[model samples]
Target chain A: MSGVEFVPLSLTPLLIGVFSAVACALPGNFLLLRRQALIGDAISHVVLPGIVVAFLVTGVVTAWPTMIGAALASLVAVVMIEAVRRLGRIEPGAAMGLTFTAMFAGGVLLLEQSDTSGVHLDVEHALYGNLEALIWLDAVGWESLLDPVALAGLPDELLRIALTLVAVGVFLWVCWRPLKLSTFDEAFAQTLGMRTSWIGLALVVVAAIAAVAAFDAVGSIIVIAMFICPPAAARLMTNRLEIQITWSVVFAVLSAVLGYILAGYGPLWLGLDNAVSAAGMIATVSGLILAACALWAPCRMRSGAPAQ
Target chain B: MTVELISDQGIAPDARHPEESPLAIRGMTVSYGQKPVVFSVDMTVQEGSMTAIIGPNGAGKSTLLKAALGIVTPLAGQAKVFGKPLRSQRHRIAYVPQRASVDWDFPTRVIDVVLMGLYRELGLLRRVRKTHLDKATSCLERVGMADFADRQIGQLSGGQQQRVFLARALAQGADLYLLDEPFAGVDAATEKAIIAVLKGLRADGKTVVAVHHDLATVHEYFDRVFLINTRKVAEGSVAEAFTPDALDRAYGGRLATAQMDRAAS
Candidate 1:
């Protein structure tokens, strides 16, 4: 176990999971705050066309254009939602449903128009992830830590993940009061001279960036699970905004690690030929955790309550 | 001007010009989609007066207030506050929306809500300091909620929640306040407390416009009333605006049989 040859095969997925948890949790807390959980679903699906278009134009998969294209696509999604709001006077959820379905359909059309190979759209790799295979890539590297037993290797995407998480965390920390008030009572927020539109736009931007980061790691399907489930679970446990955010981060990180380990060992343990995808497994666990948390929260609240 | 008009009906005080008007809306129209909710309405809220915009449901009372706050775009007319456009005079106005409009489950405290009232004054990118926090505490204290400053807003009762909103508005320290149905669903104690706070605002020479539904309480609560039914029916002292004629016009056939004794008295 001390030698490099004895390094855990689950290390790569575990790292990916940890990073995904932290990245999604920050914006997930905000999305939960705004009651715009569906926006995560919208951004995840909408980014497909952006990535596809970028690939078609650039003839290569680069991070800059991919992220930018995804951001633009997310903006388009917001505009579409606003247009539906203005024209149809429909509820926001309905608008989100209409826009995402159309954008996702457009993405499918783009993929068809480009005639990308059957292997190109690889749902298996995209939805579930191929973390074990990625450990050999140019970006993932191992760093020697102070402790000989505990070695920390920095991956290529680590900086982006770390910086995004830190920046978002600090941004929310600084704007916590405004965000809290704005999310709670937008009308009152407006009266306070806070620019509601700008705050709304900032939230959208945060959602888009978080979605983009998760897009490359686990693809669209898992991003929603990471973005919504943890915060929702956190919401059940706490009423304080700061505590909820903190709990969400903790839950996400735990789910990621648990999901990664489960996916790695399930094949050997259960005699399954194809183990579940790491992202799918993590998302499933998160959903289960949220459901369990929801069911038990009321009981706990009742038990703790004094005689009224 | 000194003579009171009296007929077989009753004595009517001469409608003297108010010392000042804080808000005025002229020929205002608001539409949702193609259909109009407020049509060619004209209203004026006097300075230092607690005015209530009253009508039955869907009478566009809230819409009129939104127009005054510049929250809703008017299709035809303009709303001026303190002799200036609402956007330019944003700092002078404070708003308290109905408590139902916000998610109580949101993770925020009473103090946090109150501090937000100072955001416009504090400007963007500037961190909130001890002074802002102190102001928030004082505002909460004014609402008699300073003890619950650290309590989550969700944990409070409906009346307490309403008081938190009032505290947030009070923290704004604005010259004008537009509250949308602040008394609805509130307990009697909370209602009296709110009225006291409104009177305090009036005493400070500020203007208040509330969208109210309780016909029984309107006269007792407001000095001025704007009777609205898509369009302005009348605007004057509560005694003048709460007449049988205005009630008939505002409520149509409904007011003929369904009379609250308070409306007549």
Candidate 2:
């Protein structure tokens, strides 16, 4: 509980978790309302292959190439899903299910076959991430907060997720009107010459960016959960889009902070020797919040319909 | 009842000014997959008229409107609005899609949905001003939905939902209004309110086109009628184009005898 242990061991990971949660949840609000929440799951599942492909092509486990690889993979997955939906005359859910699972299976096969013994590239690492290992080794105490030398040693994932969060926020703010109009009524937006198809594509691209970035930091469990749970729970709390968004952000932050603490300390409180997976714990907490909202939120039931 | 058979050639010649027609479609053909839903068809709406697009089920009545607005791609031909392409003249046109087209449960109020009609004027990043709010409120009032401004959209009945959509179109303040099946499922009062609003728009020199299904009210509601069955069957004033022969051709013998008698009466 001292500054020495908390600052060096917990600060960066906690910030990274919060940043990742918010980034995913912001776009998740629109996606959930638009009925495209599965796109988040699709993007996260395909990112593993993207990173593996990047390592194969560049022969390194660096950041930029892997990020680009993940982004490209998601784009390909989206296009493929659309193609299958159109050509095969299948529903979007089935197309997305078929595409992401195939790509993910391909990624696991590649990881098993490739000579990755020298690197920390495995399916488990991709799924749960290494949040516990991302410690600020150079920090001496709380004074490191203002010390340039110690701050420089902070985990790069923290900075990446923070930047992604800011980018996602700006995207939502700038395109707020068009996005809302399009999501609610695509035909109306198109009739007004709003290029609604482009707006829809842009939204999916932004969601893919958030998913890829968050997947790298908090792993796919938290990425998928954050993309749907917070926004869905917020949906039950309010009737206004603006207020719903605020509630989603509040829920995201609460889930990240509380979930991280519970994962790190709750087992110790119960006298267990070790901690649990932060990503899994965050996802579980978000699910719990959504369940509670569904059970008790005032606006949870549809108008004129009996509660099931 | 004796049925008068009008000549099949009812295509109106292109207006010399073109600007006088609020909507002009030329040889528009739309298809879904390999099956053509709407064949090469031409339609010209006189300015300041309330025209009804009537056809039987699967007759592509909605597809024609969607194709005209570029919401659905046409296989061939183009649509002009006031002598220009639809894209350049989008701001001067408004559309009210089918009531069943959107999810009413979306998290928005009635006033907010109406405000969407003014999206073009508001543009991006411009704060909604007092004038925009006033315009939306006035539109809602015109449609008799002002009382439901703060109500969630899902809380309204089917007829109220239709009225809200009309209110949104009214806020567009366009010269030409295109609506699809505005009276498909509504109470008698909502239908009366909607027709009154459409008549007001026409009296103010605004053009109105709607895909209407109720045969009994066609003569009473529309100033003109365009009959279609994959292609143009007849078009002109309701007395001229809504003849029994044209109805039989468009309905392909599917018009029940009682419905035809009601339509004639």
Candidate 3:
């Protein structure tokens, strides 16, 4: 592919995909270890209602209001799940399943009833985001990389996701010790005077932020996939948290790049006319990675048990 | 403060100072939903002594420890450590939750779990220095798990996992150590090593309180015993509290005949 075609069409969307994937996958390592991987799926699913509610309230499609709405929805989902689990004496998985699916159904209902025909708000757009439409139309070639005007014209989604990724990275770096300790043993962390419950809330909040940001750019499919698949696959490859995290990041980037390429050009290479959804392809790629690791990774099975 | 005020009034001048005691609880009650697991119970542990909290299943032995440590919210009462609230004196306390409480398959090495005990010293952002590593290593050595320091936590046997937990507690170097069922599923050799370490802690003037299950070992292992069944049944030295009546009260009809005979003997 010539630099001209790639820089104008693929560059911005590819960067956005990578940034969103990494941001979501970073917190995912801890969440998977803590057995709360489904929280990511729940958060992403509930984001739909949040965005729709934001559109209804503001009477316009703007980034900040929608992002705030999504974040608030994620918080409400988390609290509801906790409340149901505690009050109903139900397990966490059931609580999460019930809450997220109900919220998602409400989101779809709202989308159908609202007058969003004039805008780019729909269930299909929310699920499989228009990654193809997020193009750098102002770019002429590879030289656009250093051009001031072209950089300024970069898609807003890329900048938003980049900032989100940086924020997630800083949170992880600052709270690495407490997060690790608490995720491993909540009671022990509490006994150490760590305010472990608050730490857990903060982690969930951070994850919600990542989910909302990534959901805006790459759609919920990539957000949910990146949140669990890479970290889970990473788990099977190593028995150390530090190494597992590194491997997850690597997997996230690999999925974004490879999945984007396959979605965009793989069909064309096979004499097909159009491309597939980047979000779907990325999720599929991540699942494949997880499956491959499950089958062959050294730490796939418990250390001492006989292999099935 | 009320105790001090009363003592100042020249009533019970020989009253014990709550601060002097390693742990002092007054009327602590914890409930799960409608059922109160631990009723209004008072307990005080002497400094430099090994105390066992023995009770039947669901008698709230673990709940009492958890409530006092502020891990589980109590519906009523206060817990004082060295005469102050638990939060303020948290640094002086070390807790080893049950081995089953955590996911053993977590991806971490034994040394890292021990290093968690130094969390307060390391705080949130400070680099773990050589001194921290040395402290963690020495604690692991104390539990005879120094060689397993580099091993994955999940790879160890149940007894070895218990020892790693003990080592983590030892890393804290706290004045009071609280352990919940430290020997519930350990090999006899591991049990001996753990008891020796606990004895060594008591000898060093540190207080040790454990939720003990084995009625027979109470006499040999602990100098003090606090028996409970939803409420405090008995509390004193083993000679005073480890009686057939107290055992029967705590365990109810659930106490085995062989266990009762061992307690009586």
Candidate 4:
């Protein structure tokens, strides 16, 4: 294969994977620090029902309805989790597990009931993302980069991932301090008039947005993995919040690029003609990075580091 | 002017002139879940004095401080700082919640924790300036944690951790300070150093209120004592409120603290 042939073919999937990974990884750091990493998992599971309901009503798969449905469903999941936690007086982990799995099952059943003749919503696509389907065939030359016709013909999934990344970046840029304070010392932050409760809800909403944006291209498995693995790996590498965030983004980008190549090429080297799921490969690579960082990151190697 | 209107309503005394007192609590009732922890308490902390809130276990000493700081919601009453709500006077009041309330193993250096006091000064989207960084260092020096500023919080001893919390509060530079059990589990030397810092705050004309556990040192370290058992049993200078009668009222007639006070005297 020539450079020209491979460049246009691989560019869209790689960009989509990188942006999707970063979007989920950025907010995942705070969740990990807060010991609310499971909430990210629950949000990913719960948002499925919302998207399905939205598709059922709208009769089409569109970004606005999917986002709105996902956001609302995640909100309901959070509220139900809290209610279970408070009323049953159970541990938060148990509450989250119960609420999300039930909601996800309900969503899957509801999806089963909807007419499937014309719709693309299916259990297989939801479980394993269709990474190979997102191909931008419109780029005839460099003119396609700026031309409106070529741009319109490009895959919408990539745009969704890019906009989600931008949203995550803006959230970090603006609410960094309040988020940090509330995560570390919520009571003191409340005394400082930071409204820690509001900050907490904002965090959940942002996490939901990230999870939902990455859901279509990466599936819930990779979306949940992206929301946790890279940030956790970065956490092992540094003590500063700013540095941890930077390393997480870097790790995510690396996982996206390396994981895609390894998935697409590793099979050929092993005498298998077909490539594997790129999303699954990316998640596996992120997990491997986290495991490596856990063992050898400088901060983890220090004396009496308490073994994270 | 002679009448105290906060007797029954427990509303802050003289709400119109709350500024006359450093901190005011009126008709403050608080609950934990469904159970009431504090009920109908009222008191005004004198300006420029170190006041200790002394009570037996489960007497809501910490809860009262948290309620005043709005860290915990009050069921019926309100607390005021300089005649305004906590949010309005947030920058003017520094609060130290119980040390155990936070995750000490949080992944950040100690200097950053102390620098959190200057966060309100930064407002939204403003970075920490050199002047604020200098002030954070000075505040750490005051609490004797300057050498450990770069270390992680979990690396420190309990007393050192308490001192770091004090340093963070000091960096706030507020007129009113509310500390929840600042001396809990601290070494004698750390306790002495904290007293020196609290006394220094008084000398600087800042009001200091702490949830204190040591009855023997209450009179020696504080200018006033707020004795309570879910209610404000008594609140006045050590000469007036640190009586055996008040201690009996606050501690359900268990006089170990009163006996200890006598032995020390």
lDDT per residue, candidate 3, B1-95, as tens digits?
Answer: 43454457664211456555778988999999899999999998877779999988899999999999999999998899988888889999999
Ranking by lDDT: 3, 2, 4, 1
Residues A104-130 of candidate 3 have per-residue lDDT tens digits of 999999998999889989888888887
Q: Regarding TM-score, does 1 or 2 come out ahead?
A: 2
User: Which pairs clash in model 3?
Assistant: none
Which has the better DockQ: candidate 1, or candidate 3? 3
Top of the candidates by DockQ: 3
In the order shown, the candidates' DockQ scores are 0.32, 0.49, 0.50, 0.43
> Candidate 2 residues A40-72, lDDT tens each?
999999998899999999999988988999999
Worst 10 residues of 4 chain A by lDDT: A299-308
Stretches off by above 4 angstroms in model 4 are: A140-148, A301-308, B1-19, B253-265
Docking class of 2: acceptable
Fnat per candidate = 0.43, 0.66, 0.70, 0.55
- Model 4 chain B lowest lDDT segment of ten: B1-10
Docking class of 1: acceptable
Tell me the lDDT of model 4 at B43. Answer: 80
How high is the lDDT of residue A40 in model 3?
A: 95
Error of 3 at B86 (Å): 0.8
Per-model tally of clashing residue pairs? 1, 0, 0, 2
